[model samples]
Target: MSTGTIITGLRHRFRQLNEKPLRDDLIFYFAIIAVASVLFMALPLLTGEAAETDGMHRAWFIVAGTLIVLVQGLITGAVALLAVSLVEHFFLLFVDVHREFEKTMKSAVYALAPLILFSRAVLLGVSFAGLLLLAWFCLSTYFGVWIFHEKSKDRAVFVALATDAILAFYLHRWTVGPWLAL
Candidate 1:
């Protein structure tokens, strides 16, 4: 999916997906993680903060750190995908919608388009727009779920929204809880 589709919503992305069943969604997911990791480091570098290390060359440290972040980001991202898809499926069960795991995965991965361009803004303390993107991300995922189960509009909305609420709460806690404590 192109960057332009992020603003168009999950329905458009799913249409593109249906047109191209062979597209590799994992690459999209990893690309988003990469973008996020770069944003995570961008502020520090821009602010002239140094990458302090114990006798390690600064360049080497940055390279090594980037590699570590990429790998760790992939692993963590995979776990999150699985967990979210599972939750999406569980929510579908309540509505008697038996969507496949891969469909839910499609919903999760394509919904990540919002994060690709905006998550860094949030992490960098751009609160208002980032919060909008965050809400968009949540809504898109639920919308994707509803799209997958087209037969039950009301039930789909309920299950999808409930699932999103649960996932969003846990995600905020895990991702921001430490900073909140400070």
Candidate 2:
């Protein structure tokens, strides 16, 4: 999608039930991961720890390190996306729901925008944009359940909290956390 579309997606949280569903194309999804991974790699430079890590000061080392971080972050992010989707779907199973897994995947997909677009600012100790982005992620994920599946607000909130907990406790370390620490 274009930059305008992405910005609009962020503003709308990418979960408008009145509109068409999220595109089922894997390429579009992975493209988000790729861009996020690139942005993630750049975040560590703010602290200079990325260059300091394993003597990455040299130009060649920087190039190689960037490629490695990009690949690792991409893989980890994809796996997290799948895992979170499954978890969210599993939670929804308690209700008399009959939605496809793609619905949950769509919810999880929108949550990434907050992290990928605004997380660096949070890590950098900037303004409150990060918190808003995070709220956007969680709130969108909650609303997405209502739009895509049952209208169980409680279950939706639980799914959102669970998703955020997983990110904070587990997936964060594998994906963007390392970059922030580097």
Root-mean-square deviation per candidate: 4.8, 7.1
- Model 2 local distance difference test score: 0.67
All candidates: TM-score: 0.76, 0.65
Tens digits of per-residue lDDT, candidate 1, 1-182, equal 88658646656666666444424777777788877776666557667785655455777877777778777877877787777778877877787765567777777776666655565665556536544655676677766776655535577567667766776687674445546867
106-167 per-residue lDDT for model 2 (tens digits) = 77776665566565666665655545665677777777776666567787777777666665
Against the reference, the lDDT scores of all candidates come to 0.67, 0.67
Candidate 1 weakest lDDT stretch, 10 residues: 14-23
Estimate the TM-score for candidate 2. 0.65
* Clash pairs, model 1 backbone: none
Where does candidate 2 stray beyond 4 Å? Answer: 1-25, 43-57, 127-133, 150-155, 161-182
